[model samples]
Target: MVSQPHIVFLTETWLSNKIPSSLIIGALPYTILRFDRSSRGGGVAIIIRDYLSYSTVTLPSSEHEITCIDLFHQSAYIRLCVVYRPPTYSLSKSESLITCLSDIHASSPHPIVIIGDFNSDSLCTHPTPIDRLFLDFQISVDLTHCHMFPTRGNRCIDWIIANDPSLIPTISIVPPFPSCDHSGLSFSLSSPQSPSLPSQIRDFTRVDYSAFFNYLLSVDWFSLFCDCPDIDSIYSAFSSAIHSAIDLFVPYRTPRPPSLSYPPHIRRLIKHRDALFSKVHLPSVRILFDQCSKKLLFEIDKWTRYSTRKKLSRVNDLYRHISSLTKPKLSIPELVSPQNLPVFDSISKSNLLASEFASHFTLDDGCLPSLSSSRVPPSLSLFTFFPHEVYKSLRKLSPTCSTGHDAIPQIIFSKCAYALITKEFQSALNCVFDWTQCNQLSLSASKCSHIRIGSKQASPWYSINSTVLPLENNVRDLGAQVRSDLKNSSSIKMRAQKATSKMFLLLKALPFNCPSILILTKPMFFHYLASPFWNPHYSSDIATLEKVQHTFTRQLFYRCFPSPDYPLSLPSYSDRIKTFGLRALTERSVIDRTSSFGINIELTTSTPRYHSFPVRISRWYSQLPDSIRTAPNIRMFKRRLENHPIIAHLAKLT
Candidate 1:
């Protein structure tokens, strides 16, 4: 009520005559019109926002609890009625309610909206007389409960009914109010709003690297930090110098407009339809509204087909966009502390969730080896920071990557890679490390995890700073989850499911039986639709992925040719490939994986066979023909393999 809804209709408030209005609607910004039972357990209330001008309408009969109000908004009146019929109420009471509704309809020339918990499930075989009465009144009742889960038992007894169905607004069932079994319903009459613009971001790819490096070189570091006595002072001076260089060289750029949720043409049609609907009472306006609505729907269908065809031409981009749009939203579970006490407030819930995660990750210090007793290798000295090693490390950091707990951007580190190798930077790094070690200011050992990928039987545990960091069977590293067995079955299955979902969505968007367009787009669909599921770096069993691709292809074939006996006339996998110029998943994966690595196959004995790039390359190399294998150099061998008829054909698909 305090949030000031235009009109709120509450049923079964359970307020008796004894409970005063001041107690129920205390300090709320609403004018209430309620029908209360003289005894216990049956009541109805309609709370209108204070800004709205409304008057209570007296019913001819008061056999059942009902609240009627005529609300004035934007120079128009709307007859709002809230009804609550007790289960024990007789058929006569229902008839009386319906008669009151008829009287109100005859008196009010404006649009009418009736909302209530009629305590009748219209879908039930034994329909109540109240339901029949509503049907007789020509009222449209929406029995589709907004809540997916049960509000009370398994039935949706509450309904929002309107004389004109279109006036019944969009309703959302939010979480139940405290101690209430019924979920709260929030609704709005307005049409959906357009999506707001995305935030502006810098285009780092367009940065002038040559100008940036030249600016860095021009900076006289010795002159700027001549008076600095300590490592900290030198670090500050260097940071300022690098930032100045960056500001001079790096220019900001605005990206192209983001994709609209609804196409502009469709939005225009919807606006036109809504405008016509507003003047629906007039005979001319009513006819035009009907025509406009039909036109709007036809345009939407036409646009959907056009957009689907366009997206199918660039299927990879479509899949990526859909994946981003359908990414799972994060929601916090009901927070409960270790003591089993429930937390209600958002701040408390957030803190409890963080604490629970911390507790799960925290390790026992007693289980770890003492740091004092541990031997430190002379070559692994923290005091010395080699400029070349520092430069290499900084260069490896991705400029577009996320920041850490320190809130320092990766671009800052990447831009200053050259400066990091300087003597002053090295000294500063060593000083920071020494200070951290002395004061125990490093990240808590409990907050960090150590993962060892190997056979499950031989999984290893690790310790840091005398605290044993917990070992995990699965750990997320650089966005991909790594498992102890090193098998990519789970990852492959997840990717396949996502791809299948996206394909189905695209199929739904496109019109069926457009054989010419489907044929033209088939190759593009296979090439890019499957790209999301194919990861060159991850080793997935070829047979599993092939099955997924084969299933998708078969479904696509059926869609394009929807005859009942289509499968009987369908060609074999190889025959279809030759006819459609489609490549097998195994060949496509091999070609893509081989091409990604190029000729830089560095074999290391220490690397695990499953994860080793050289091992994979060697396996593929063994399958090559003698002509490709006999090349004098790695570069020539790669060229020959890439140009081979089979590999070249498969590469074209990718």
Candidate 2:
């Protein structure tokens, strides 16, 4: 159902001149003809079967990327043209394209078909000048549009218009190619297309996660983490175990196509809009037509919003949604070498980077400050990681399934975390710094430091890799600042300054005055200020954290409100939050913690309660009713908990 088309007519390919067309087609029995847009937007291409005899036809203007070709089929010529008119395609350019198409139609003796995304918004009653011009040209040529179903978010923008109505007997909306939003148009022109082979993908849902976790737990991971004796063997054993688990558990199934057909009420609205579209020139009919069109478009938008909300409700779905919004990677063709030559090859580029880095370094003097060796200095160590700490970190891991250079997916680690949090796993993490055992990750000797907590003067010199470590009063690690005196006032002040700057920086960077854009982009804000679900934090710390959000809502109020004298007119923060159906960040965090605790309470029962977090978690869990605690998933738990007195005051924002 996905890839059955012979002459694939693709609109808005966005192919630029930089990429070679040959690279895209690969070693296929098809030839591609593309009109690439130089800067951005409005690119189109058509891939035809190489066995088919076809000749390219020229248009008068090169303002838009359009493909026109004449195909010789059974001793008769079929003039086929694929054109895309972007919503942003200027009226003049639209007119030019139509004029060119008109002239070509006037000259050609063979039956012609112009098919592509016109961005005409077939559902909208009041059409733009471009849509009208395209329609007028279609009417002039006596073309019949065979796009029966809506494509491109409630609008039948993509159409296959033919001069001879019988040329295309039928058309239906099909699932689009992977990564495409617009649905596919499958139509017949004398011959029916062969059904595409259904593709198979790993059915992750079928895999028994609980069983897999238990299997991994039963294995003696001490061999892999500590007893492997070498880095290479450790890596190999880890990889092998992951692969073996996959072979034994995960199953494969053919992917199912998503529903393309819209609701009947929407279909009715579209028909009504199309019917009134003919008499849009009449003022009285135009009003009713526009009302119908607005209602239809609003309905589609409403569902689209609901889908977005559903995505943001869960961790996995949120990750997928974020991935979808990621911008296209910028391509840099070459790197400059010392010789002022362009280095295109990967090896040369790596060499250039390595050489530059190696050359740019400060000379280190082979000297050490003399110190008293009589007294031994105390040193902090991470020889063992507590199970609770490991479990806490593991549960926070997003199952995006993204892998680093290790070739192991995060989902594997996350889903199997409950079982994988063994003493051996803890050893593996602790062994990250143990150079004698697993020398996989070498610490930079120059960047290494030692900070003595008790004494102002250094006790003794510590050296690694023949380099002496520098003693410092203050050091920052993983975005947290630590002082030898163990004071946090300076760190708090620094954080406040940084936060203030960032808040102002964001305000200056974006204009939230436009409520429409702000509403559309509100999900991003929710993601930024996420509900902390791990454990309940101190009230003081929570209040300090809430200041960030408090500042944001304040800024948002001023930016979104239109009043000149805003101070007196503005409502209190609590009222404002309630009006927006949003809860305090602390409230959200508490709810999230309770919900997470409810999901893992049974699994964590055997785990030793070494930390105060578990005690606090139990207290919070006790507050919840039996129904809320027994809920199947975190999503359900949170929903059920929202009705309790603890979280009932907080409204569901989405």
Model 1, 1-654: lDDT tens digits are 113356678898887543445434433444567798777878899866545556667687776788897665554567778888777767786777767767776776777777787776654556667666655555333223332323455666676666565655577654343345565666775422333455665667878899888888888878988999999999999999887876776767766863334677767766776676456558899678667767766776677667656665565654553443333322232344566344558998788768777865534344432344535432234334675554444445434445444333333434344333343333544444454565545656677675665432343344555566687777766645577777556666655555555455444434644644444433433543345334444434445556655765676667665677777987677775555556666565555455432343444444344345445555565556777767776677667765677674433332
* Clash tally for model 1: 0
Q: Give per-model TM-scores.
A: 0.37, 0.33
Candidate 2: give its CA RMSD in angstroms: 20.8
How many collisions per candidate?
A: 0, 0
Question: Which stretches of candidate 2 lie above 4 Å from their native place?
Answer: 1-335, 341-443, 451-461, 465-536, 596-612, 625-636, 648-654
lDDT of 1: 0.59
How far is 302's C-alpha from truth in model 1 (Å)?
Answer: 6.1
The worst-scoring run of ten residues by lDDT in candidate 2 lies at: 375-384
